[model samples]
Target chain A: MDSTPEFVRLWTSHQAEIRRYLFLVVPRARDAEEVLQDVSVRLWEKWDQYDPNRPFVPWAIRFAYLEALKWRQRQAREKLVFSDALLVQLDASYEEEVPFLEARRRALQGCLRKLGDNERRWLWLRYGGHGAVKAEAVESGKKLRKVYYALEKIRVLLLDCVAGTLKQEGWSDA
Target chain B: MLKKTSRLDVLLGRAAEEMLSPEEATELEEILTRDPEARKRYLQYLDLHAELEESFQLHAVAGGLGSVFFPGVSGWRLWTGAAACAACGMLFASVAWAYATPVIQKAQRRTIFTENFEDRLAHQPTGLPRAPGAWSGDDASVVGAENGVLPKTGNSMLRFLRSTHAEENTPKSAWCDIYRLVELSTPPALGSRLSLSASFAVAPASDGEQFDIYVGLNALDTYPVQAPDLDTARNLSNTTLGRRLPATRNGKWHELSVDTQVSPQTRYVLVHLAMLRRVPGPSPSHVQFAGHYVDDIKLDLLPSNALPVKTP
Candidate 1:
C-alpha cells in the first residue's frame, strides 16, 4: 500500500466529498461515518490499484459506493432507506450541484457577518457545540419548544440571506 | 413582520436535525414528489446545514467563533488549527510538485544536438548543394522516389542501393557511408559520457541483402575525406563507438543508440550511418535491388549525474 505524499494529498482533497456521498446512501450519520472510516482504510490498502492519470474523486467514490452497499447490507434489518437507483440519482444530483454549493458556501460568510448578535449566539449554541436541544433549552432558560422554533427561525433567515446574496451574484434556480 | 413557518419549513428543519418521525418523513417525501420547489428548497437547506457543520468545525478552533454560548471552542480551535495547517502544507507540496516536476526532468538531461532531415530532399535537382549537415559517399544517393520506401520523419533521407551479378557465387559486399559533424562550444572533459543514436529502415529486394549501422567519432583534423569501408571505418578515427545490426529486413524503422565516453583530445563528433550487404554465391537469376534509408540523427552529451561514476 503506497502512502506517498501525493496519494495522501489526493485523499485529503476528496475526503469531504466521499463522506457526503456515503452519507447520502447510508441510513444514518453514524453508519455513514463508519463507512467513511472503512473506505479510508480500504483506499490505503488498495492504493496501488488507483490510476494516477484518472480523476481521483470518481475513483474514490467508486470504492466509497461499494463500502456503503456493504454497510447497507449489514443494516438490512433496519428501517427502509433509499434504494440503489434513488441513491444513484441523488449522487448525480449532488455532483451537478457541487459548483452551486460552493458558491453558496462562499456567500454564507458574508451572510453570517450580517447576522444579529442574538442570531449568531443561537447558531453557535445549536451547531457550534455538541449539546442536546434539552441541554441548550435548560442553559438558555427557554422552553424546549421555543428553542427548536428559534433554531428553525435562524435557519430560515440564513437560507433567505444566502439566496439573496446568490441572486445578486447572478445565481438562478434554472 | 415575522413570516409564518410553513409545513415544508417544519419538515425540512426536522429532516436536517435527523429527528423527523416516520409520518413526517412520509409527508416530506410526498411533498418532495409533488412540488419541484419543495425539493429544491430541501436540497438547499440540507447543503446549508452541512456547510454550517463544516464551518463550525473550522472556525471553532481558531477562536474565530465569537460566541460565549458555545463552550469548548478553545479546545476545538487548537486541534482543528493543527490539522488545517498540516492539510494546507500537504496541498502546497502537491501544487509545488505539479509545477516543478517537468522543469526538473528537462534540466537533468539536455539535448546537445539533433537532426530530423527536414531541410534535405531525397532527390534534388542538378547543381544544388547536398543537405547542409550531411556528407554522403560517391555510391550513395538521396532516394526521394515516390514509389520507394518513405522517410521515417520528413520527406527525404540518405539512401544506398546495391545490386548483385547473378552468377557470382562468391560472397560480395557493397556499402555507403553517410556522416554529419557536430561542434560543441567546449570540449568535453575526459570521461564525460555522450550518446549517439539514429533511425534507419531497409528494403531488401532479395534475400541476400542486409543492412547495418556503424558509428564513429574523430578529431576535426583527421575526419574522413571520403566514405570509409567497413574495415577502414573500424580503424579510422579517434574511436569506433559501436555498431547495431538489425535481424530483419522488413522495411520498418529501427532506432540504434550508443553511449561512449569523451576523450580529452576529442574535438569533432562524426556519426556514421552505414548500409552494408553480403550476397552469397549463385545470387538471383536477375539483378536485385537493396536500399537503406536513414533519418533523425542525434548526439546527446549526457549530464554528469546521469553517467556512472568512473573509478578513480
Candidate 2:
C-alpha cells in the first residue's frame, strides 16, 4: 500500500544473494551467519540510505564486506595472532579469477542439483569436516599436499560444470 | 585512436589481474617509470582489481550460503516487523512528551530550606549586678523560675561577663547566659523533623574570650555527639527569629541551635558550654568562643512528627 511494501519486496528478493555474499566473505560458517544477522539489522535500520536507482547487489555487498571485516578483526584481536597475509593473498587470487569465479559458482549450483545421492554424499564428506582433501589424505596414506592437489583437480572439474551451466543461461563470457 | 586504445587496454587488464610474475612485476615497474600514461594505467588496474576481488568473494559467499544465512521470507514474522515499527514510534512520542515536575519541585524546596536555615545568638545584657538570684523581676522566659530574669553569676559575668580590659573601647554591659529552654516538647517517634532557634551575646572579658554552645534532645549523649565549633555557628534569620533584636560588638550577640530528628524515648535535654579563644601569631585563624555570653534566648519548636506510622 505504501513505500513499505516496495522496500520489503526489495529486501526479501535480495536475501539469498546477500546471504551467499556473507558466506564467501566470512570464512567460518557460524561467524558468517552472525554477520548475516548483523547486516540484516543494519540494512533495516538504514534502509532509507539505499538508492533505488542503483544496483542493490553492490550496495548490499559493501555493507556485508564491512561487517565481515569487523568480525575478522574481532577474531584477530581475541586470538592475538593469525595469518591475515594468507587471507589477503587468497583474496587477491579471487580478484584475478573473477570471470572464472562467477562461472564456477554458478556451475557449482547446477552440479549440486545434478549430483546423485552417492555423489552428493561424497561432496558433503569432502567439504563436511576438515574438507575432502584433509579427510581423504588421512585415510589414503597419501601425502597431504598430493591429496590437496587431487581435490583441487576435482574442484576445477566441478567449476567447469558450473561454467557450462552459466553458458546454458546465456552467460557465454562466463 | 582505436588501435592505440586497444593495445593500452590489453596491457592494463593483464596488470590488473596480476598475471605478472616476479619478472613481470619488475617489468611493469620499469614501464611505469618510463611512461607516465602506462604508470597511470597500471595503478588504475590495480585499484579495479582490488575492488573486483572483493566483489567476487562477496558474490560467491552470498550464492553458496544464502538460505542457511537468511531463511528466505518464511511467514508469521510479518506481524513482528509491523509491531516493532509501531512500538518504536510510540516510544519516541512518549519520551518526547515526558516532563519531571515533581523531581524539580523537590530539588527547589531542598535548596530553599538549606539556604534559609540558621541558628544565631545575640548579647542583650540585664545591666544587673553579679548576684545569686534572678535580675530584679526581669521577666524573660524560664521554665521553673518565678520571674523572667535569670540569676546573675557571682563576680564573673553572671554566667556571662564583660572584659574589664576592653579592646574596642565599647561600653560594658551585664551579659546573660543563653540556655536551651528544655521540656518534653518533641514527640516520642522516629523520623521526626524538628528545628530550634535561640540567640545570645558574649561580653568582652579580661582575657579575650569566646563561647561554646550545644543543643541536645533528651540526654546530651544522643545526636551528632559534640557540638560543631562556634566559629561556624550563625544566628537565626530575622524572619525566623520573629524580630530584629539589638546588636553587640565586644558584647556581640550570637545565636545557635540545631535542627534534627526526634528519636524514640527522648526526655531530658542539656546545653554544654566551653570557653573559646583566638590564639595569636603564626597560629590558626580559628576563632574560639570558650564561654557563654547570651541573654534572654527565645526558642520556637516545630511539631513535625504528628503523623502516626501505619503498621504493615
TM-score of chain A of each: 0.81, 0.59
The residue ranges of model 2 lying beyond 4 angstroms of the native Cα positions read A1-7, A78-103, A109-121, A124-153, A160-174, B1-312
lDDT of 1 at B70: 39
Native interface contact recovery, all models: 0.19, 0.00
TM-score of 1: 0.47
Task: Tell me the tens digit of each residue's lDDT in model 1 across B52-77.
Answer: 77776555443243323333333333
- Report the C-alpha lDDT of model 2 over A3-26, residue by residue, as the tens digit: 555456456656765765554444
Candidate 1 residue spans exceeding 4 A from truth: A1-4, B33-37, B67-312
Instruction: For candidate 2, write residues B1-312 as lDDT tens digits.
Output: 012233344434444322335454445445544554553333333333333333323322212212222222112221222223332443332221211111111111111011111112112233211221122111122211111322222111223332221222324212222323133444434544345434444444556332233322222223222332211111110011111122222344344445544444544233222222212222232232333333333333334322221222
> Which 10 successive residues of model 2 chain A have the least lDDT summed?
A121-130
lDDT of 2: 0.37
